[model samples]
Target chain A: MHFVDMLVHRWDLARALGRPYAAPDELTRVLNPCGGSAARLAPDDRLLPGDRPGRVTTPAIDDRDDRRGPRAEHGGPTALARRTGRKGSYPMWCSSVLRRPRRLFAVAVLAVAFPGLAACGSGSGGAASAAAPAYAPAATPTATSGAGAGGGTTPPSTPAPMPGMSGMATGAPGAGGATAAGKPVSATRVAIQNFAFSPATVTVKAGTTVTWTNQDSDPHTVTAKSGAGPDSPTLDQGATYQYTFTKAGQYAYLCTIHPFMLGTVVVTP
Target chain B: MSRRQLARHGAWFGAAVALSVVGGEVISSVVGGTTSAAAAADDTATLRFVQVSDSHLGFTGTANPDVTGSFAHAIDQVNALPYRPDFVMHTGDLTHLSTAAQFDQVKQMLGGVRAGSVHTVPGEHDAIHDHGRGYLSTFGAGSAGDGWYSFDLKGVHVLALVNTLSLEKLGHLGPDQLDFVRRDVAGLSSDTPILVFSHIPLFAMYPEWGWGTDDAAQALSHLRRFSSVTCLNGHVHQLFTKTEGTVTFHSATTTAYPLPRPGVGPAPTPQTLPAGRLRAALGIREVSHVQGQTTLAIKDSVLS
Candidate 1:
């Protein structure tokens, strides 16, 4: 229950920041705004990151034209990733935040579900051990809490960390187990098509070569969002940007031109 | 949402439906300009041409690292078409970063088009830091003020206007060109099928991203009287369309890099989608029309 609660809060923060909030719920997806004239697929119907190579001719159906004519027979990837539905309105955020009953209901539900969870952690031997799990959800935002996560040593008899704690966290999946730059990836391929990247997330063993080819007519870059990844050359159509991930760590990246389009590469030891 | 990005776009969506497709404000009345009618289309188009916009030559970026390759592909698509167009029209942005060498490369590349002639309108990129003096020297043949011109072929009136030459907050055509539009079409018959071309959109697409032209209302007002008018433009880097009465506006996609849909991002920056998805975002658009057929005038707008 506590883990579930923590996941919800992290999901909330991710959604609020307009970041990728892959809580794995299949029902939610921001509607794609490309002016295509066709019915859209339900969110659950979208393929997951490692799902089968998905392809569908763009339903470039012209809504204004009454006759269902033959479509444009062009080949390209499906630009299916969508922004969250929260369309950048501060007032809307304020309103959603101000709704108090939802909070009360959440508390009521948590109380009913785990009745006396206040008793669960107090029985635990030390605070540090219980708090170690907190690092996964709220590590980046709160400096003090994150620093506390550095050591597993617990002062015996300290009470367990309380639930419902709030702080910023950066729990990049497949993160932080590096053996210093491994080797050039053994010819991995990432295709750039339909204004999107295929296999938005990739997990590869160390010592593999990753090649990014821009199949779109647009130019894009494979830029590391943080330390420990190679910056790619601006790739044109049929141009490939190669980067050898030498270390075992999760690397978050985005197209510098289109920052909203994001991807992550996980190098496993 | 970065706090700053959210705050900035929040203001736009607050007063308007930022996410609304073709928001209500886009529909409208006339601005100030002479309203003269144009001739209607004939049973068949006597002449056919292809419009290429935003080739953005010399651009080097991750969004589309190989700009020339795509431009060449577009040219190749044109060359390989079954029916030869009477001419090819390049809307603008013949060069990215507006270098002399870039312009020369584009000119050399464009010289390979199979059309009888190539007509051009300067995009802001072509005007470069020198304010269009370079563009005027290269492609400004028979053009009037700031590289805006008009010519007649196949009984259709084609007007190429340069809105990128002198831009304000949005694109600006200036009073001179607005007046030119007034006088240029004044003598034409009411039934002529007028085709207007420009770089930046003459309509307000998204003011936050500077996708609109400030004085385009004046130019559009002059075109209002025309019975059948089609306005084709490029520069937002994606395809979109809006129709006002007899006048229909189509924004062409780029042959360089794809830009975000209007209001999807703060500005019209190039887009990078998930891996294996970029090809879906890029493709060549070819338009075919035959006389004696019910032509879907805005067919190319749906190519994406």
Candidate 2:
């Protein structure tokens, strides 16, 4: 699909610009998950009988029960991303996938029905983490405190969290213990500068409030990566958008206007 | 619905969620961007011009099977305007891949517009393999060193700048063009309403995506004394506006495909919205500055 082609293109650009990019581990995990997850298949993978010509399968949709909504947690690989043993971003991904009515039923079903397969995708996160240490949660906090116009907010002790890929494998040493206890950075301020969200990833305790201030001359947005997050109106210079995280999970976002300005919010319980 | 019927419904699916910012306040709306342009045109507006960007003429994506079709529809919107605009300015990206044929198709298609004159700048895509020799040769008449030039039109000075050539971290305006902007605006009075055009934004809209111009500040510094300045650009492929001092920056949407918002993803590629949402995401914008006004009144209407 075009998404795959785009992902490869992004890698090339990230390198060209000297920006850190996550290896396409989770993205290409299965290369073929059952039938409709991410990439369809490699040339060598055997095709399913129904996938062949003249099969005329009902539009690949599966209507799930209301109880198992698109946002419901499931163990599956197609999820946006999650560390091993952690809740995956699949639910949010499903919520966004449902935007297309024609494939809504099929993708919704894929999100909830295949959690068993989701387990396979998590193993790759741990391996990918070692490849990009610049994104580790520990080095996230920056020195400048982004407190409103009045000032007096101290920056977090940890370095600034990496931007771009928010899906680091924070699993405990033995793995499967996603309680990595992300360094709690009380300074919940993110500044938009040079077209990037400074401290691309932020860690906070559940129920904490975070604010994004735009320092760039042009407009930027704080939109959920899954199209399900509380999107902000376009913000110009000196404009700020605020949101409070009420749950513990990995919530990813990007500016709908400049999809390349990606950021993530990791909340710990 | 059948695939054909779903596509029929998809044509009307672009329900544009929009917002209007006046003087520093935000007003939001989620109307289906299907309203006609004539329905929003104003007769007494002081100055008027139609802004068209990202008309990727040769694009063949499922996002909208018929990019040329939608572009033609946009032309119809411009022709149907109740009052003829002083001039129609295409910010940039006229062709998807910068092909001679694509450029010709765009020129042939735009020839049908009812506006007084057609002016343009090059987008990175327009200069693809040919490096813009094709673009300048076709529409480069009267342009400066590159495809950047300025003209006085109906009391307004319009500058068409080409920043797509030799782009670095962001679109670049080398020393020559920056000097051109300096000398171009030096002769004009402080009261002239200035309209500057280019394919990429002159401001740092989102430098991460190369949406901003690297040395645009140097170009803008020359016009600080002007009472009104409107800078229009395409490339990010969306509608955004901002004002700083005497300058107002407007990033226009595309007549071809929509790209994700800044930081919404890893790249600014064509976005394929779910069916029934394409129209809301695609369309054209109309801008006008009244005689004594300091700001331009911009109206963005989506293709129904």
Candidate 3:
């Protein structure tokens, strides 16, 4: 775990000092699966041992698996991102590294050269990409296109994936063809800042997905005060969590991390 | 060296260190060294106590999926100590969301801890929604207004303060609390040892994150005459130490998740650490107050 911490710390330090950083080849090879198989990349989501800091045991990712894994026809940011489809394992590997212009090329080249591989890998990529899957894949048919759209424009400073709700919807209009009639669900955004939710009360349509973006640096969660309201994961600064209100009622919610941060979401028929 | 300079220099001593005031100047040295303060005390006479902070019970996040389990581990660690501590001071943030159920669960869990007694101050989380009325009902039995009170334990004056309430930009100690501090320590002699406990750090460790108290200086001024004053706090979810004049502040680590260091990120968000490292980041502190030493011997131990 120290290895990942050291790696993330190095990236954080480099970013803080305005320096460019790339992971060592050992971490890349050990963590990044050339096959791009989400199942093979599953172990990467768990904590790793720092016992062998400089040496990471390589996983078996070969060209033979290319036939078994997802398609790898085109290799640039768009193609690789489209593979983010149902499983978000690939973008999880890129994380902060995805923002660097050249790493995209490196990942693209990696994808083409290794036909089996669909995404690049780095330290705890799943942590950042976990926030992406919520809005990206469900709204789009390809499911994975959110990675390319959200990751491409995200700055290294904003390690969390850009709100896929905005970036992905526009970036991949073709992918949204399946749900074109009902696809473009305009989400009502609630700002969480200064330890309180802005506009404390929000009224939206029944099917509207109310997204809470934490503008505050401190962590916050949108939880139901009574019955079912908005149950969200911990939202860090620049990180977002959305809940679609399917029924019409007065749903009261508050930041579970800071219960005093109260807000109400009224859904109308 | 002048008294101010001596206290400032004494702060530099690392762990297992001892410090004392002599001729109006503080002197410090590594413990067990032939230092005047360490040599003068009898180890058996030391008053040993434990400090556990930010348990954040009922919290479940990626950083720590089982906060209740981890807090239980911390209490077990305290109980497994070779010697049961005189008392346990939980600096604050006992629950993630200050629900009555969370309070009850934490209270029952704390009851399992083997200590002389368990005391606490309120963290902002503890005052959630109701301004600490819920917390006061559960833990504020003998505490004064807003759960601030002081008591004498084995010749050491211990003050449990409430600075997490009515916070604006920083932790605030309103006039009522400040007055309590003045009156509490008014009769104590200059040589009496003083220990102040609060959830937010009294010193401006990082005001931008609301880590410091706005009116702590006033409270400190009332205790400045004492030969030794130590302030312990537990909000930032990380270990930090600062020394000013005669008082040294120590911020304890949480039994819950870890937060980013001051200015390390956009906000003091709980860091989602890689696996198997969460326990290393969460732990407890044991403080030993020796008879002759003005400063307590502080030792931080991580949960195994």
Best by TM-score: 3
Candidates 2 and 3 compared: the better one by TM-score is 3
Q: Report the lDDT tens digits of candidate 3 across residue range B1-304.
A: 2333333322111112233333333333322233345444434444456777898887766767888877877776667555556678888899877889999998898899787788989998887757799899999999999999888766777899998867654688899999999988899899787888899888665443566677776888798788778888888776554343356666777778777654343346667766775544443333344445443344444443
Clashing pairs in 3: A35-A116, A35-A117, A36-A117, A36-A118, A84-A144, A85-A143, A85-A144, A92-A125
The C-alpha TM-scores of every prediction are 0.47, 0.48, 0.51
lDDT of 2: 0.54
- Residue range A17-125, candidate 3, lDDT tens digits: 6565555545544444653432122111111112122221222112122212333332222333434322222222124443233454344334323322333342233
Candidate that scores best on lDDT: 3
Q: Can you give the DockQ of every candidate in the order shown?
A: 0.02, 0.03, 0.03
* Candidate 2 structure quality by residue, lDDT tens digits, B1-304: 2233322322332222222222222222222222233234453433455767777787776666788987887777666556576577787778866678998999998899777787889887777545589999989988879888888765777788888877644688889998999989988899787878888887655444566776777788898778767787888777665444467766776777777654343335456777886665554443434344533444445445
- The DockQ-based CAPRI class assigned to model 3 is incorrect
> Per-residue CA lDDT of candidate 1, range A55-162, in tens?
211113232321222121210011111011111111111223311323322432232222223213324312321322111101011111111221122111111121
Order of the predicted models by DockQ, top scorer first:
3, 2, 1
Q: Rank the candidates by lDDT, best first.
A: 3, 2, 1
Better structure of 1 and 2 per lDDT = 2
Q: What is the lDDT of residue A187 in candidate 3?
A: 32
Give the alpha-carbon lDDT of every model. 0.51, 0.54, 0.56
